[model samples]
Target: MIPVLWHLGNVVVDLVLDVPALPERGGDVLATRTEHTPGGGFNVMAAAARQGLAVTYAGAHGTGPFGDRARAALHTEGIGILLAPRTSGDTGFVVCLVDADGERTFVTSPGAEASLTPADLAELRPGAGDLVYITGYGLLHDSNRAALLGLLPRLDPAVTLVTDPGPLAGDIPTEALETLLTRSDWWSCNAREAALLTGLDDPAEAARALQSRLGRGAVLVRTGPDGCLLHHGGRLVAVPGFAVDAVDLNGAGDAHTGVFMAALARGADPVAAAHRANAGAALAVTASGPATAPDAAQLDAFLN
Candidate 1:
């Protein structure tokens, strides 16, 4: 069977520390809780696998302690990993500190996650009717970016590309971003990312601008709490989000996109898929880390 889901991107473990207040330089603060789990592309693949898809995670990991732990973590999540060994360097990591309001500040270290090459993409080639999810971060790096772009045009028309341009800081070239978006069937982004992409403040406006740029189908703009808006199918529709007690916001968006793609792979309608995605994301933030994402049955139960 063809893989219903394919993720070619960075895989890292995130360590979260929640503090009452974000501390300043030279200030001492105690964290409320410290939680660590697999994050990024690995997290997305794990979430999708739990939703009962045939998922493959193709990326890079180091031979160091963090990489070993990260691979083990992916195994526990039931994600199939196509890992490239890193001869030297630690695996990727994020040190996130969430404040009382649930906002987080991150200090990211891209270690092994940054080492993926075009050679890695060759291992997980797609057949007809497969879906590939590409992260913007992976495409920012030179070696991997060329590899990623090379795979795009060759994608079977039966295949659909879902992209999350996560944090398009100066790393990702503008032309690469445009090319990726131009090739993708569905584009998912949060409010800030939407704004950065379209230069629009309102989420709805951002969706409109993005749709205009792409001009083929819908643009999914994820608004925190207010819900996600889709500008496509000749209309602007909103998928209402559940109000959940958010512990840590890390991986919530990725969880939403993962399950959303799973639903699409199952041939669900766009609106219905969005609802399913919304429920999945709600379940994701209830826990402190990525591994706690709900499975298909659990997400359905939550919906019921």
Candidate 2:
């Protein structure tokens, strides 16, 4: 059975410019490349589909060029998209500049992304055996957050919920995080997100804290370069990421989350599935864009 991934969150276009160094005010920088790719919710959906998962993405986008680009991009990856109506405001966009070390700084205009409201939840209806991946920002905002909270009771018991508290997941109130975690089978976060969420300086402790807060849900803390720690019931499992000369770290974590969810949907054990996700994510950074995620064959070869 093919894994069906339901992604709900903001959709934007990443306009990335490779500069020799960070740009200065009133100064011009030469960009090695300028490219736009589907970001946020769509990025996760596209990555999952590339790894052979069947994906459906429901999100808001303006009727501008950015929205058109997002739709075209998702369709190219075989992702089913349910686009929200266009608004008079500008489409969502993130202007990012990457330095020599592959570190990125972003300037964002939420625009249509911020317009995604509770009413938009009507688009999601997951079946048994499907994996629901909720992006963090959707649950951070009051309106959409309530919508996501209300939908928890409707989730099929056979369906697994994988929550990616994107960059802002930790910034939300603890009560909100608790509400989302209660319905999640897996809680995935990066080192920074773990620290921010649990107020624990150490990622391992943060993982434990999150696990405790979620009661029975598994806490997966992603430590870039060092690997990931999966915490459950006072026990921890370490899944190290594959070593690769990473060019761009954009969407690597999302790739990991998508692949791990896909593996879980395929009935793989958590540890093994995490290892596979590591491989897929490791392959992700070798390229520069959100769609850089590898297919099953590429991941299998990398694993071999």
Candidate 3:
């Protein structure tokens, strides 16, 4: 079988709104624009699929309209949905408020995605050399967290686990968080998450410290439009990113990660993969909507 990229993360709909600025604690503001689409873990799988990597979403989808959208988006992207539709509740959604500077604030209302069991995890069935993508959201909920921890050690040793400590990184229990990072074969996250994990405010320091703990594994700290800091094989290098006028920062990190994993699956060098990821992210941010990572041809054109 071709090496597959399995996403053991939640997929949800995003209700995105464009605003001049964030509202105060007891304030209100009108949105300049509004959009609704499948987001969260979906972005990574979509980006990977765009690069011709076979991808699968091994998470729960609910029984309502939101779940319907998630399933439709996955099918349109040609990504396989590994788990059956969840019945307890509809798939969840997040309200994203984008400010003028492209920063975002999110308010989430979780549903069926927060619930998972050992039985649900059994369907993951990853193959040797397959890539497993884990988002921090999976570790936030009690049920999902237990299921993931139990399934981690059972995964085939040949499978490479990539964990991205998302915005929820701070809320994850210390022991569990450390365990996840220690067990991961590859760790990718933004500068804020790097600090939250390592207690080092400096991105470079956090990258070095985190990479050292991985033994033979690698770590990447994304720095937005400036690019990323990649620490692998005892060397840390700043992989320059393509600078662009960022209209939206949503899905940029996911684009970078999906492209990076696909590159590694295709046997590209780590540094070269990082370069592609950075370029792919730059292209993603230039677009207004999420799930905007470019195809191979677009990436090549940008690089050339």
Candidate 4:
């Protein structure tokens, strides 16, 4: 079987509000535009599909408007949904306040996607050479974490597991984080996430420490402007990023993860894939939305 990206993470609706700046404590501030779009794990799945990887989503969703939008997006992106939607509640959403500087703050309220059952994931069966993407967001929820932990062992050992300990890496329980990291074949995250996870401010030291936590897998620590540090096997490589005027920071990391995994699945070495991923992320930040990750031709054009 060929490599397919199986995303076992949460998907949510993004209630994006563009503003000039954040409000003061207990103060109200409002401004420009608003958009409701699918985000979270959806960004990574979309990025992978855009790079020509077949993708599937096995996470729980609900039977409400947010869930409807989420499924619609998955279908539009040509991704398959393995689990049925929950009958009780709708999907979750994140209220994103994007300031003029393209930085964002989120207020998230998880809905049905926060609860996952072993039964909901029974249909998932990844074959050899498939790429499985796991996010740290699921570990934050009790039911989701239990279900995710249970599902991990069922995946074929030949399938590569890529773990991205998401934004709030500091919040994930240590045992759970270690279990996830050791089972995963590759770990990837940005500079801030690395610092938060390791409590070391320096990216290089953080990368080394995080890499040591794993059994034999590699680590990638992304430094926003300077590109990424990839430690594959035993060698550490510094891959430079393409500089662009970043208009939005959201989904840039997802773009990098998706494209990087896609490149690796398509037979590129870690360094080469990181180069492609850097270009993909650079292009992603130049756009305004969460799902703005470039497709093959677009990425090629940017690289050229």
Candidate 5:
């Protein structure tokens, strides 16, 4: 199988607090419960690692409790860490407030992960058949934006570049976003991000617009429980999502992207890969934390 090199510097510890509802301004509400877990980039990389993919995380870890926990979680999942802790700052963390309906709002404190340098990118030597994954969050921070942009031209032409602009898709600089669209082999994002990027309300139209921009690439528009729409090889296909009782919607998209990339690396066709991704995402939502993606056996059982 081809290696999946995940450029995931956004790993963080998530402190999830369950609340009855969002508190109004100046009002305080007590949380019903709290759970701490590994989140952010770990959600994506762990999802692929659990599927038995040769996954490597090319990112920085910081010192402190958050970084310690993050390292331990990666070790537990059998994922490789190619980068060492270089930053003096502590690892980042987020306070996730989940409401009764499972909707979550996050307040984040970014740290060392937001300071990726160009030297870090130069160290990554991806070759043909390797898939490189990046997210929009990496582009949002000013400290890392130039580094990420510089890394793009240095990437091997034979390497497949996959990107998910995430919810901050609209906030990315126009030039950077254009470069990514032109260079990306596979572009994946949720419906809201699609609309923001292409200004198209219909997902199919959004997918088409994005595909056209890619010239020789494909586009995937993930539409929550309704599943995803794919535009590839001049054809538009709708991949239906699996029906499952969703307990936590967080990280579902990350799970889908991870599994989709893993399946493709293992020689599955686009539609077949999408099916497995759907199953993996369904299973992810049935669990609580952001890093709750299923392993190969669990994914197979769910599909069966």
Candidate 6:
């Protein structure tokens, strides 16, 4: 079985508060309700685990209440943890304010997730047929960024590197972005993130631009509700999304990515893998919480 080396470290507790509307500058508003769940890269990890993938999480999980919770969550999802050396700080948390429309805004607090080092990655040995998943959050942090960059060149040449630049793609330094693109075997991003990275509004064009920049990789541009675009081998294919009543859009993209990678590892073609991913993402948004991705049975039912 192919392993997915998930470079996920920022295991955060998300305090989700439902509010009528966002407050204006210097204003205040009362939240109707609040809930907590494992978040951050946990979303991606959980999603992949649900697909029955062999996933190893390579990140820091500190010794604290939040870390304990993250550890429990990972175990529950059957995800293997390759934590970085223990650090002084606790695990991180984020305050997510969701409006009536389910749009979310976040205020984050960094923690052990930012403590990744080259040494930690050196301990992880990925061989051919393995997929290494990375997020832009890791690349934005100074320490983690350096470690990730330094670890890239040392990875097995046949190991595929997949990256999701997240919302912070625009903030990554040009040199770092170039290096990441050069090393990436597959680039995944939502429409907004695609626009931020490529300055292209059209998802297809953005995928093409990213693929061109990567020179030898494929690109997947996710278009929420409308599905995703896959660009590879000088061809572009539109993988249509499933139509579902979305309750929360939080982990949909992460679910798509996780399921997509799992399908790839299972030897599915790119388009077929994307179809399965789209179904998984559709099911994800119909529920709540960041790590509420469907298991393989649920995904099979949804796809059927």
Once model 6 is optimally superposed onto the true structure by TM-score, how far is the C-alpha of residue 37 displaced, in angstroms?
Answer: 1.2
lDDT (Cα, tens digit) per residue for candidate 6, span 1-304: 4566565546778888888999999999999988888888888888888888888888877778888888888888888887643659788899988888777788889888888877777767788888888888887788888888888887888888888998778998888888988988889999999999888898888888888899558899999999999997789999999999988787788899988888888889999999999999999988877777899999998777
Q: Please, what is the whole-model Cα lDDT of each candidate in the order they appear? A: 0.81, 0.80, 0.89, 0.90, 0.85, 0.84
State every prediction's TM-score relative to the real structure: 0.94, 0.92, 0.97, 0.98, 0.96, 0.96
Instruction: Enumerate residue pairs that collide in model 6.
Output: none
Error of 6 at 156 (Å): 1.4
Looking at candidate 6, the ten consecutive residues that score lowest on lDDT are: 1-10
Better of 1 and 3 by lDDT: 3
Between candidates 2 and 6, the lDDT winner: 6
Candidate 6 yields a Cα-based lDDT of 0.84
Off by over 4 Å in 5: none
* lDDT tens digits by residue: candidate 5, 89-173: 7779989898888777888888778878777777777877788887888888876777777877878887878889988799999
Report the C-alpha lDDT of model 1 over 1-304, residue by residue, as the tens digit: 6456778878887888889999899897999898786677877787788888887777778888788888887777677776656888878898878888777787778897787766676655577678888888887778778888878777877678888888663356888888876878898889998888777888988888888778354689889776799876878999899998987777788888888888888889988998998998888888876555689999988998
RMSD (CA, Å), candidate 4 to true, equals 1.0
- Error (Å) of candidate 6 at residue 253 is 0.8
Ranking by TM-score: 4, 3, 6, 5, 1, 2
> Model 6, residue 217: displacement in angstroms?
0.9
In order of lDDT, best first, we have 4, 3, 5, 6, 1, 2
Model 6, residue 224: distance off in Å is 0.3
RMSD score of candidate 5 (Å) = 1.4
Candidate 2 Cα RMSD (Å): 2.1
Selected candidate, larger TM-score, 1 vs 6: 6
Candidate 4 structure quality by residue, lDDT tens digits, 126-194: 889998888989999988888778888888888899999888888988888988887888989988999
